[model samples]
Target: MYKEPIFLKPVFKDRIWGGTKLREEFGYDIPTETTGECWGISAHSHGPSEVINGPLKGKTLDQVWDKHRELFADQEGEDFPLLVKILDAKTDLSVQVHPDDSYAREVEGEAFGKTECWYVINCEPGAELVYGHHANSKLQFEQMVAENRWDELLRKVSIKPGDFVYVPNGTIHAIGAGTMILETQQSSDVTYRVYDYDRRDDAGNPRELHIEKSIEVAMIPHVDADFEPVLSGNEDLRMKKLVRENYFTVYHWNLAGSVSKIENPAYLLVSVLDGEGELKVEGETSSSFKKGDHFILPSTIKNFAMNGNARFIVSHPTI
Candidate 1:
């Protein structure tokens, strides 16, 4: 049997902190207050995911996890490598931090640490994000979290479209309201959420906060970014490298015409950003996709081709 790619329709995650209706793809429920993000594809461990396309098409992401176990965090000693998600922020997210590989190994007994990057897809007026902190120690951060002095302790940065922010493991961060962010990260969803503005969940209960773990794992002494991906071209088809590391190499490929001969890579994740196109992979029937469509291509695809003009973000492991 020839294996085709997998297209995942992400399950909706309603939060006290989301805003995106997640239009175009998932028919996710919207809230009355409208202060939450529409998370597509990958989400926290709180909920499972909906697989919407490709070979693993129409299957839950967790079903795949139970069967293969090598495509996610590999907690059972498999080789699953990364996690990717789209964030639609209608309100500010809680301040939080993630553990690094060493910390995760020693403290949490996890397979890998969390490191991620965000690419701004949409930004409303005055939109911003919390990238890191100004503090030099855990004590100062704890005090800030306690006193609700986020503005003082956090390094708030204004954002616009075409901006990219890298959040390495242990970096204190949060996504602000009115911004849509595409996040690519290590497969594990072990986040240490520190603060949540006293918001309650749908059950009207205060959500959990991992303050002690957050403080212990949060990065201090901010690392300034002197690096940005070079814009490669500006044709009907455009390719911009978002981030390249051992974990993954992501590229923004825009198109209006047919793109041919892409069949080999360890794995490829195609997220349609705009327009529409028909894709032929693994000798199966071609599939049509438009804005917000996505598929996970296996390493065995041969003679793959795309018909029509459509823009998509592609991600694959660097190895």
Candidate 2:
């Protein structure tokens, strides 16, 4: 049976639009000044996380998933289904779209497609994101792209800390500059860039744009889904159900002292965003956790209790 929480070491990624907030705010030993993303609890091929604690120390999450299926409650999938990341956007990201599962399987040869949600960790005042497009039809979308009418076609929304947005596949979107967010998504990296705002790579060439593929996959008229968070808790701990969809379930948990609960899901992914805490598994073991710590509570741990004042973003795959 699982006793100790499996803590994972994050893998960092550098991006042209990245910044140093990951280092300054989260106290991470960032690799570069332009380090943009931290793959905190990921098992994706691009950046698999390494276990830093317990018996599984030094093994990658992907290795554990393949060898110790029971740790994940024997989830039926060839690859891990979920990926969690923290993004620090110093400049605007490329305007892009992603294909759904069917499209991704057929075209990209991937098992999952990205349907991501973002928790706004922090942002500058007047910060905005390119959430959707104004095009009413496929024809209009193509026309706008051809005519270079970005200002008229892109829909910008002002944002702040603590805001959350759900982005399903086929939705054209971009993270604007001066924003930091924690992103939870399916374990796929098939992005179809539609616009890059004339940005060039270090090689002095314009970034590639997938016009045909993007047009084939993008939604004709982007429609935002209404997701109302379910709030429930007691005097000690408060839980905010962020998104419960086909891909995954996410929540924000705030703990004041201590709370006890039975563990029933396949597994639990916990990321401490603020404060410190200690987790104890009944008749097993306990571990001290602090801000910026990320871990997994395996299904074998049937009951657990958390004590101390802390805030977290917790998630688990749906299938």
Candidate 3:
């Protein structure tokens, strides 16, 4: 059994709404100037992360999940349950919605629905995004879209760095321009686009919109899903319980000194957001980590110790 942290190599994604900030801020060797996303900790078929260290080095995350099921405590899922990403939106994203589990399993034939949450990393001053709609019914929603009454239909909200937003399936939303976020999401990637600002590709073709499917999946009379994040920790280590949904639980770890004896029965997905640190398991040598590093603390590790100043976004599947 592997008892060390499984470090991962991130996979970059290019997007029309992307910019060079991913390279400028995180110092990533981005593939293009318009690199929009870093799939930091993912096992989705489209962009699975590769193991960069340990005996599993060179293996894709999906391969580990298949061959070494014990690494995850043998969690019961046909596919990896979570995906972690950092998205840099140079311009506004398409107004989109995702289907729930039942719809995804039946229609898209996917293992999971795309319910995701965002931790705002940085945003331009006075940044705002489309959160929901003011439509009272499906008919009214269709009417507003048909009329091109975007201002009246979309509900925008101001946002800033350090803010967190939970976007479940069927939530109509878009990431605004000049914004960056660390997103924790289900492994599925089924998005139904409602609007795209009439954008066109390099070939001069308008991007396709799933108007009917978007309408079918979007929540009528949008309801805000309320969450109460809890905080706990000692003086040197602070932990904020960001969200504990049916699929996964996420946390923000702020460390200044050291924490020994940290343990979790299940595996952990960890992404270092800032600063540097060293992690040491009971018998293994210490491993140094810094900003933009992502790794998995497998169940076989049992416990570990972390030292130094660092901030981390950590999550685990709900097994």
Over the stretch 41-100, how does candidate 1's per-residue lDDT look in tens digits? 442354445676545655665567567544432335343556667777777788788898
User: What digit string (tens of lDDT, one per residue) describes model 2 on residues 1-319?
Assistant: 6678899999999999998999999999999999999999999999999999888999999999999999898998889899999999999999999999999999999998889999999999999999889999999999999999999999999999999999999999999999999999999989999999999999999999999999999988989977899999887889899999999999999999888874546699998888998888884587999999999999888778889999899999886
Instruction: Quantify how close model 1 is to the true structure by its C-alpha RMSD in Å.
Output: 3.7
Task: Mark the 10 consecutive residues where model 2 has the least summed lDDT.
Answer: 257-266
Error of 1 at 270 (Å): 1.6
Residue pairs that clash (backbone atoms under 3 angstroms), model 3: none
Clashes of 2: 0
Cα lDDT for residue 201, candidate 3? 90
Per-candidate Cα lDDT values, in order, are 0.70, 0.92, 0.93
- Candidate numbers sorted by TM-score from highest down: 3, 2, 1
Candidate 1 at 60: error in angstroms? 3.6
